[model samples]
Structure formats: structure tokens, C-alpha cells
Target: MWSWVAHRITGFAIFFFLLVHVLDTSLVRVAPETYNAVIGTYKNPIMGIGEAGLVAAIVFHAFNGLRIVLIDFWAKGVKYQKRMFWIVLALFVVTMAGFLPRHLMHVFGGN
Candidate 1:
């Protein structure tokens, strides 16, 4: 139940982030300075946290999606759905642990 809710929420988060990312990237064609300025805003501490969250959303959404696919296609998957969810969660945590520190270091480590 909660996994379903989390999957949906993370899907939406990734979708909206992609939408904004595309829109902002498109600004590069309109004006380089504008694009740079807009991208510069993401350098702040708050946006660094937001970027980390975005990465988390993407990672969770991807793993949950794979779980859903397995549940749908594999006969044994549904039987083990709860366990699979836990595995997905553990994978998410492991992936985030590996990703977040490096990401934060890049974001806050300074140039």
C-alpha cells in the first residue's frame, strides 16, 4: 500500500523534475546568459538538497518500476511482492547512500 503510494509520488516527482529540467535546458538555445543564470540558481544549498531529493526520487521510482514489471510478468513475483518491496527499498537506500555523498560533495565541495 505504502509502496504503491511512494511509487506514484516518486513518479510524479521525476516527471515534474524532468519537465523543469527540459524547460530550463531549452533556455540554452534562447540565450546562453539566461541559461547560465537559471542554472546558477541551482548552486544554492537549498537547491542542492532538492537535487539530492530529485536523485532519490529517480532512483526509487526506477527500482519500484522494475519491481512492478516483475510483479506483472513473473509468476512468482506476486507471491513475493512484499519481500520484493523490501528488497527494492533496501536497494534504494544503498543506491542513495552511494550517490548522495558524492553528489553533495560535488554540489557543496566548491570549485
Candidate 2:
């Protein structure tokens, strides 16, 4: 139940992020300087954190989606759904653990 809710929420988040990404990228053609200025604002630590969140969302959504597929297709899928959810979470945690530190250092290094 919670995974379903999280999946839907993350889907919406990713959609909106892509929408904004498209709009901002379009500015590059209409006004390159404006695009540059808009992109420049993301150099701060706050946006870096936001980027991390976005990556986290993407990773979780992907793995959970695979779990959903297995649930739908495999004959034994339903029986092990709960365990699969835990596996999905384990993967999410390990991936984020690997990603967060390097990304945060880059963001906070002020280089």
C-alpha cells in the first residue's frame, strides 16, 4: 500500500521535473543568456540537494517498477511481493548511500 502511494507520488514528481526541464531547456534557443542565468542559479547547495532528491526518486521508481513487473508477470510474484518490496528498499538505500556522499561533496566543495 505504501509502496503504491510512493510510486504514484514519485511518478508525478518526475513528470513535473521533466516539464520544468523542458521549459528551461527551451529557453536556451529563445534566449541563451536567460537560459544561462537560469541554470546558473542551480549552482548553490540547495539545488544540489534537490538534484540528489531527483536522483533518489528516479532510482526508487525504477526498482519498484521492476518489482511491480515481476509481481504482474511471474507466477510466484504475488507470494513474494512483500519480500520484493524490502529488496527494492535495500537497493534504494545502497544506491543512495553510494551516490549521496560524492554528490554532496561536489556540491559543498564550493569549487
- How far residue 40's Cα lies from its native spot in candidate 2, in Å, is 1.3
Off by over 4 Å in 2: none
Q: Quote each prediction's TM-score.
A: 0.94, 0.91
lDDT of 2 by residue, 32-63 (tens): 79999998877788999999999999999999
Off by over 4 Å in 1: none
Cα error, residue 51 of model 1, in Å, equals 0.6
lDDT on C-alpha atoms for all candidate structures: 0.92, 0.95
TM-score of model number 2: 0.91
TM-score of 1: 0.94
